[model samples]
Target chain A: METPNPNIKMWQGNVACAEGALAAGCRFFAGYPITPSSEIAEVLSLRLPKLGGNFIQMEDEIAAMGATIGASLGGVKAMTATSGPGFSLKQENIGFAAMAEIPCVVVNVQRGGPSTGLPTHAAQGDVMQARWGTHGDHPIIALAPGSVRETYDMTVKAFNLAEKYRTPVILLSDEIVGHLTEKVEVPPIESLGLTDRKKPTVPPEQYRPYEMDSSDIPPMANFGEGYRYHVTGLAHDETGFPTNNPEKIQAQLERLNRKIERYRDEIVEVEVQYTEDAEILVISFGSTARSVRRAVINAREQGIKAGLLRLKTIWPFPGKEIEAISASVRKIIVAEMNLGQLAHEVEWATRRSKPVVRINKINGEPITPNEIFNAIIRQD
Target chain B: MDYLYYLRQDKMPHIWCDGCGHGIILKSILRCVDKLGWDKNDIALVSGIGCSSRTPGYVDFNTLHTTHGRALAFATGLKIANPKLHVIVVSGDGDATAIGGNHFIHAARRNIDITMIIYNNYIYGMTGGQVSPTTPAHKKASTAPYGNPDEPFDISRLAQAAGATYVARSTVYHVGKMDNYIGNALQKTGFSVVEILTPCPTSYGRRNKEGNGVDMMRYQKENTIGIEKAKNMSAEALAGKIVTGVFVDKEQESYLNRYNEVIKKAQSGV
Candidate 1:
């Protein structure tokens, strides 16, 4: 293992993401260039090969996703980075990785859009899409980072979660945090807590690729490991063959969902600051959380008690945490770049116990601290 | 006699319909593997969505049935990640030429060390006879009921043009020849393509004027001309006939080989 360099240096968010993936033991990267996310690909292209890892610039986003899944199956930690339009194209293969239970990481450095709305600007419009973008009821884990340093830490968390759960994890970033340059301290490789998927314990003849024990996460046998098995996107039995049996289908779907649901507390992470005695609570994530912190500080100085709830794990939506905050605060303010996407989730979790107000921006710009401060002070 | 060792006995009664030629192609591939004496664990069978894609289910090897038209893309990743493992992709006409057409050409251009066998039945068999990219003009399909107007793609020529190091074509009736071609493909160090013209009897035969499985076999035997013979035949005489032989065979560095060179250069800090 290489010694950790304690030297602090300025780095872009996307560059930090690539460094973090390397620190987390990602050995294969397949990506197609898309704005606000290409730096991760560009840096990895130069860096991965030197480390004896592989980097492939695939023909398109669809191929990039496919290649990442394949590399993961081959017993290497793999990842891909893309933006809005590319993320849309990757949905089908993302669903494949979900059904096949392949471990991989996907970083979507979000740009504005329903379709290429703004290639170089910031937007958190993909929050709902990240959770339910792929067509199915499969479980997904997505992490949102608030700063360049958090981008590095969350990317490492993303790979660890993906391997521990044996599923694909998404690192959701908007253009603001992705492009922002900040001072980051590079941690030693040994300091990062890296996790790998559990390998099967049985002999080759008795191995079943998807057979679950008490943990619900089946051991994944790598290809060419002498335990030959089949994997498919079709609803399959524990033996990993296509099955249309209603009972088997129900069991398979339940296992996929429950693996994450049962361990939601461990998989979900959030940053809660000054919320214990505050009357007003601010809910924010990703690049917008940076401004929300500033807004909360300014509001507190104006004699209004305010706190910020920054979501680190955006999916498996920290409902328990939100419920506790809703019970304590008088009003909940949700600020994001998109038009009230996460606000609806806050409302759903609170069950209307408190008023949930949304401060939305959709003109391809980051939500500024001043804008959030004004929203906090408004009487309505 | 020991051929059954290659199969997963529990997954018997494969989903391929009776008289379908996918079985013959699968058997030929298995024979090639046996002939080469490859360890089963070292081979990864990959496929996309089609009747032909169901092959990975019956074969007792590390198999992946990926999304539609992306088997080659997936196989490319598998091969690059572990260069020692042999990756083979089995795809149908529509799966290879329509949805996955871009991946097919790109894989060829990179010359990745993968053997891709295209089962060209000229129609989308799994979806009930939709007009595929290789569906012959004037053939009736569910999607093209009134004498299809689309021209078909010559897969062998297309693969050769796209830079596959080894390219060959053979029909189901030419079983021995297919085994030979597949064996050669497996031996090649770069991207190798073997286009197998198979029969989708239930979906394609009844819709066209072709009679039955046996009749389709007879048509294949009668319509295909050897490449050597094709050289002497007039253009008008060989217009509808399939030319069966190797189109391109040469040595070139594959994607993994070139990538390893890059790794060495980058690591040297030169």
Candidate 2:
């Protein structure tokens, strides 16, 4: 990655993500205004049009998701940003994008939730929602950024993964990191390894929107690309037309999952530090991970053998990594703002081999480093 | 039968029920596009979930069968993404004006260049003739077993009020006018709405004593008034009459044209 702009400049996390989108060749954004996440839309609104791309403030969150998918199908990299309430509204179309295999990014700035719990406040309560928000058995790729720099990096990766897998990728940012300002070295556009969706190798007459003999990811043909094809929410055959045949529909369902699942090693990313000969492994992600990192460092200086595992990829959960690390570790601590969303996943991943401790806080405040540090010292 | 070139023969026969008037509207849409000499690839046909939304399944164009009541929103993005693609959304009465009403009015407000073809059968036919936003007060729907008490919406008037550049209405019986209005709406450079009155014999007609599809067409022919003729009729005399024809027609810069202006101002170092 050509060294991320080569200089440090002060930028808000949302601003950095917006700049990253522009640098990553994202040409379209359709969004609705909501708390915490509105800055992403506001910044993109000003810059996308300048690049001869588009940015539309849609009627609602669902409409924003619809427009994002539509723009992507029209042959452009597209995204939409929203907070909790808006994320809830976009679930239907998010599932539609999953079923129809449209490449787009949805940014959900985590806030206090359930309903309109806390809009402006910081809380990482949307982890479970981000993974299973949309209905049915489907596949999604989500990235969580723990800092301003990672926000830029992950936003670019979100678009790349979405295009690469022909699936909707989520950049699950929380309120604290979303509003946080820090120095980031942004890379130039030419330096980034941007990826686009694969196009058909065959002629338009023989083009199938969802067909691959060996590769799970199918080549996508845009609406106006002289390949007249159908895209539907219903279970569809390889030709992109709705089908009821049990064999074809079963194959279609399996393909949607396998496309991303088979390449889990490449899609999953996590930051592991000091896990060698460690007794207590601390696991966290996004804004909460920042505090956990500090606590882990403080734990190390205090003569306690502690390690930090900060997640960059939330979905296709890093089970293998967690399971492997559990062999040497005496116990694991899963810290998050929510009650037990990712902690549940951690427990399932470790298979109860190591006792797990949860640092949970759902109040409209961040999980402080001292709080996590206390949990680190008190644990026997 | 030359219009058969536009049909995806392999995907047929369509899912529409017997005596359903949706096929008539579908043919008119194909006829209009064919008459315009449009390349099949240039046309993007989008639809929400309904019997009418099923029209896209039979077409050989760039078709999209979207989630219920989201055709216009999706089409808006497609149009904005590439201002050159002809994006046409076919939504049902319930799909467009009920669940999808907000998107409908908003799309018109932007005046984006897209043709919205509404199949107004006055009932939610796909869901077994439930009461829809356009169901007449006295019509019998499944939900309105004893007759609907709520007033119906005038779709053409709604579009005109919401700032759609082209607005027209025609019945399935008025085949020529339906084709003409669809063609006109397709050619317009802003958000255009053409609501065509069709029949739902299986669900609505059986409940409303409106007889079969032929009987419904007969009623439309007898009780409908052209926009020109309705001008002379008093409000009292126009009661119970389906007013048909062009309601709004004018030109303005579409959403894309105005957005291009935004790009100009953004790029300029002023």
Prediction RMSDs, each to the true structure: 1.9, 2.1
What is the alpha-carbon interface RMSD for each candidate? 0.6, 0.6
Which candidate achieves the best DockQ against the true structure? Answer: 2
TM-score of each candidate's B chain against the true B chain: 0.98, 0.98
The alpha-carbon root-mean-square deviation between model 1 and the true structure, to one decimal in Å, is: 1.9
Q: Lowest-scoring 10 consecutive residues by lDDT in candidate 1 chain A?
A: A2-11
- Docking model 1 quality class: high
Model 2, first chain, TM-score of 0.97
Query: Can you list the residue pairs that collide in candidate 2?
Result: A4-A186, A4-A187, A5-A186, A5-A187
Q: After aligning candidate 2 to the native by TM-score, how far in Å is the CA of B133 from where it should be?
A: 0.6
On a 0 to 1 TM-score scale, where does candidate 2 land against the true structure?
A: 0.98
lDDT of 1 by residue, A191-299 (tens): 7789999999999889888886799999999999999999999999999999999999899889988999999999988898889888889999998999999999998
Task: Tell me how far the alpha carbon of residue B104 in candidate 2 is from the true structure, in angstroms, after superposition.
Answer: 0.3
lDDT of 2 by residue, B1-270 (tens): 496798889877888888889999999998898889988889999999998999998999999999999998899888888777899999999999999999999999999899999999999887888999999898888899888999989999999999999999999999999999999999999899999999888988889888998998899999999999999999999998999999999998999999999999999944
